[model samples]
Target: MSSSGTPTPWSYAFIRLLFRFVLKIFYGSIVVEGTHNIPKTGRPCIVCANHSNSLTDALLLVTSIPPKDRNMLRLTAKATQFGQRTFTSWLIESAGTVPIKRRKDYVEGSVDNTDIMQHLMEALELGDAICLFPEGMSRYHPTIAPLKTGVARLVSDVLTRNRNNPDFEISVLNCSVTYMHRQHFRSDVLVSFHPPMTFSPKTHPELLAPIDYNNIRLLTTQMHEQISSGTIDSPSWDLVRVAKLAARIYAPLGTRMSLGDHVRVVRAFLEAFKAAEDGPEVDGEHPEEDEKTPAETAELAQLRLDLRTYQDQLARWGIKDDRIRRQPLPRHTILSRIIVRLTWSLCLFSISFPGLMLWVPVFLTTFYAVHNFKKTGPIFDTWDEIAQYKLIYGLMSGLCVWFGSAVVTFPFTVVTFLLVPALMWMTLRWLEDAVSAFRAFSALVRLLLVGKPTLRAMHVRREDLHARVMRLAVETLRLPEDSEAYFARHGGKEKGRVRGPWESGSRYFSIKRRRKRDWNETLRLYDVVDYPKE
Candidate 1:
């Protein structure tokens, strides 16, 4: 196992490259934005993000960093991950993660954070960037959990030591990661970085004059707002669903929307609906700024009802909005595409046929193992853990099969072992392509079966809904349907400015931006009483 200290740059780069490949295989697409916001190499900084997935969040965040500066990352993991002397432990430790035992993860009186805090401080002093999930625990939720005080406290303590020295400073970068399907294989994810939040004597002289409880709270609130802006935070899953559907329906047919833009549209819907529900804040400073007229509020309500109706309509058909958005092609056109897709799948299958013969047993064993194990698998609190277990089990099962085969074919052992990973890669490609082709065929068949009149009716309804929503988004929210136009209007000359919906302290997001309520108390308003620990 490698030590937790920084590794050689080359080694770190190689590891990053390896994980990048692994992630690409696991996810359909990993879109990273705001690379420009990453702090310079050797800068003392803390990278913070909302945690929804368990280990996958960390892997995605770490690999998203530029290769040259990847060596500067020091990940923070749960202490339990390093408790066992196993490959999992070695892998995490080799990644240079410091282990922190959260109070909830152990007996109430058994956890200590002194060493963990020391390690993080030392890492920062050495100019290494430490990454942490301020929300503490990873779980499936519609919004960010209440942040723990660790990050705020750490920054205050570090600043206290530096005392009024402008030469020594620390930056905090907030990365927001969103998953299209957190547990599904080959789903998409987006990682967005916002401008770094810096705290130094030159920037904030008051914090150094004396950091107090209020200062810590202020820093924590700022961190919360920054991270929240970058992520998809909603009051409930119902709003999340409705918002996603509205965004989907609002898009033009066959338009390729970036994950960031899609997220912005969804946030627009969520904030608009939430604002109407929360009603006017009489005491709000900018009451007139965002106070929607009665007609507009009623229009929003009508839009919500229409969106829900459309959602149910799509659900009844058991199809995604994309299917509806895809402009109808001539029968011959779809048939031609189907044939091409099938032919491509056949070609890939033929190429991988030889490897499949050798790896079929391993694949079947893995399938059966996962199937049986899941029944008795350790109960997990998050959907990401299900994927995590599949990954671990698949790796272990494949290795065992390779070792056993090597032993059985003693003389050809070297060749057998060498071929394992290569064959596995070929099989993976074939399976993915074949499954994709089959899904396309199924969708095409369903399309063919549906009457053209029904499709036309659905299209008409979609178009009307799209027009109304886009108008409201443009006029009411000042968020245009066209992402480029919105960016141009807002002077987002640089990338990562799809945040217009939440910018300028819009009254709709007033509670989120101003954070008037205590963080914990606000969490209770969301009915999340069981606060997670870091």
Candidate 2:
């Protein structure tokens, strides 16, 4: 590693490749959008993002960038992490992570971070992209926290130092990382990059002086808003879960909505509810003596209660809304359905048996270690637990599989060492595939027999409630009947095409071509607000 916090070319390339491979294996799918917003090559830019997942957040952001734009990327982490363990410090150092003492550390009489600050400034001066999580620390929060002023200070320092250099420019780019099922293996992740917020020296030469308190606050708030724009900032995870299910049910049947689209629609519904709650009255007249009528208040309350109830029922039944939505009641007779399920179960069992035998020990050991570790430690947040479990389990089990197999087969021949490790690796891959197959089989059994009637009833009730809510939204909000008209007015249109904020380059991730219709269908389904016609 170079002394100035920038990685040597070879080390950078190696670490980048390693991270890509590891992320690919850990996450079932990773979707990235708005890559076009990142300049292929340009002046140093600060990439700011929300912090939730521990080390995984940094890894995802770094890997998501295109290789051409990724080479110059440098990341920062809390200094305490480097001090805790030799392995961690070495790993982060190898990846070119700069360590800075946090405010708490300063209070504890830790050495000043002037050297670290110099390292960062030097890296930026060399035109390297740097990523920082403005939240200062990771937690299991559903929304972004109050941002620290470190980012603002760094930007100010860099820009002020280079004020006389017209050719040098600094920009702050907003990125958001949304996990579909965080803490679960094989979960999906969506990484989105938004357009850069440029701060040109020529345009604002007065910023050459040291940044003041007000300017730092203003800059931090602006960056926070930009980063938070792409994320669904909910009050609670339960609310988010309920909102997603409601969005899915309200969405037209047979339409395939991407997880990102599902999240966007959920956020919109939450926003609408918030707006209604804050509004003085539903209409000009109040049904009650107060601003809120009894009926209107009751309906809103019931809506929330029903959503929570539905979520509880789904959890109790150990089934998800998607499974019910995708695999609706089969048109076959009971006997035929039974036979089909049995056949599928047998097929899955046959494929998964060998891998299960080989990998069961590793899986069980990792699971036990994670749970026990959590119990012994200071309360671990969700993402922290996930990061710890994944890192420990992945390293420990991987080593066991590679070396244990070699030791066991040593008597056979020298070639047995290489062959055994290869075989073990292949078995691990097969185990992942088997786990997916088994989950599908389990879901099918639940849908077809275990809770079929209950699912059907819930689906019916969900549809009814959705319809009632839509009607309520229309009446209370005075929404337009035709969604296209609403879209045309609120969303900018060109050549008969309407673009909502979700489609903005700096707002949200875009869906694939095949799923584009699904997103549009969802928008149409919930486009209840009325805006004045142009």
Candidate 3:
């Protein structure tokens, strides 16, 4: 058995490189911000992040560390993940995971975490960066869950043990990972790091004085706030979906907003909503409770109803608000574009038909396995389960294809072994591209043929509601109505000015800009009662 403070083996480093390569190929992009916040080398550090996606969260945290700061990141996983088989156990062990018996895995009060803490303390003392999820388990909700005290306890123990060593210091860093769409393939991720926080045994003796409960609670609260900062803590995916659509409608027509921009707007709106629901805090200048008048409350309820109706209408149309906002062309023009896109897609498919056919079985098996897993997996575990299952199934299927191809070509030459794997990979790549092209073509067809009239009406209603919401934000929220500021904050440039729908060539207006400012400051306008208000 490997000791706790042992240096990372060569095998772990090799596997980490392979993991990074696979993540780069799997995720469309992983944008890292605030890299400077990572503590300098030579001291122990603990990285605490919100846990949402299962294995992907740990994978990203380890991979995002710069090469200079790179070391074995010792991660904690449930004992079940370590597996019972020798081969599986060896694979997980070699990857630098510390297995712990979780509370859920045992009867109440029976689980003991002393060994886990000991292992973590030893690793930290040896200067390894330790990554652990404070939330304990992955969640489906947008906001951070009430954190378990394990992290706080770990920090406490480490600080207590190293107090006599003058040169030893420990820092805890907050990392927040936001996914564009967690369950969707090829979606983007933003990993934001906050400045490291240090707790000294000298400053707060209670941290080390017999495992003080009050001190631990305070520390845990601080960690929770830091981790939750700048993250989208939505109540549910449905509200997120609504917020996204509303944001698209709230923007100037024809603007092609990037996914990051969309998420920013959604997050801003959620924040605003939270502030509104909380009312004003008790300051000397404000009332203890800034109670809303009955009339105002009624008006707000009506507005929410309208928004929900709009969301349902969007669902029925089979199109997203952003798609409508981006492609504001006439019916005839949209039809023409669909035809052109379909023709291009058909041409590519024809060219890739041979490769597609060869890879079809592998793709089908992988897809079916992922779909069934999603259907049967626990709701909160959906993303993690799908990601792990897909990766394993894909590798297994690839090997099967390679071996089959090699056998068929074996009579020709020994070179078939290498050639077959390369060919199989190429075929899979072509099939993936072909499928993407087909999906795009199909979406365009749906918009033009099935959703034409509904989309036209939705566009008008979206514009009107957007104007009303902006008015509410300005008058009620006391937010500014600065178009330039909104565009600047959203990372978009204003093209021209807003124009009336009746204006000439309005059907295909420049998605670039609008002249008139609809409303100004962004607001979080989603419902509060459905999901925990925060």
**TM-score versus the correct structure, for each prediction:** 0.78, 0.76, 0.78
What are the per-residue Cα lDDT tens digits for candidate 1 across 1-534?
Answer: 112334445545555666676677566557788999887766788999988878778878878998565465778898889968876676677776789888788875777788889888877877778999999988777779888878988887787777746687888998888876665555667799999988776666666636567887888888899888876787777777777776655553223355666667678778888877666667866648678777777778788888888877766655556667646667887788878877866776787687776666755765675567557633345444655554555556666876887888889999988877677665665555555555556566666677567777887888788788878777777775575454335522122233446653352223211211111111010112221222
Candidate 2 lDDT by residue in tens digits, 423-527: 544554444433444444555555666556766777787677767656644665444444434444442221123245554532212221111222211111111
Clashing pairs in 1: none
Per-residue CA lDDT of model 3 for 308-413, tens digit only, reads 7877765564444555554366778777877777776677567667666556766687789888877876666574556655555665676677677767876854
Candidate lDDT (C-alpha), each: 0.68, 0.63, 0.64
Clashes of 1: 0
TM-score: the better of candidates 2 and 3:
3
Error (Å) of candidate 1 at residue 454 is 3.3
Candidate 1 residue-wise lDDT at 348: 64
Give the TM-score comparing model 3 with the true structure, all chains together: 0.78
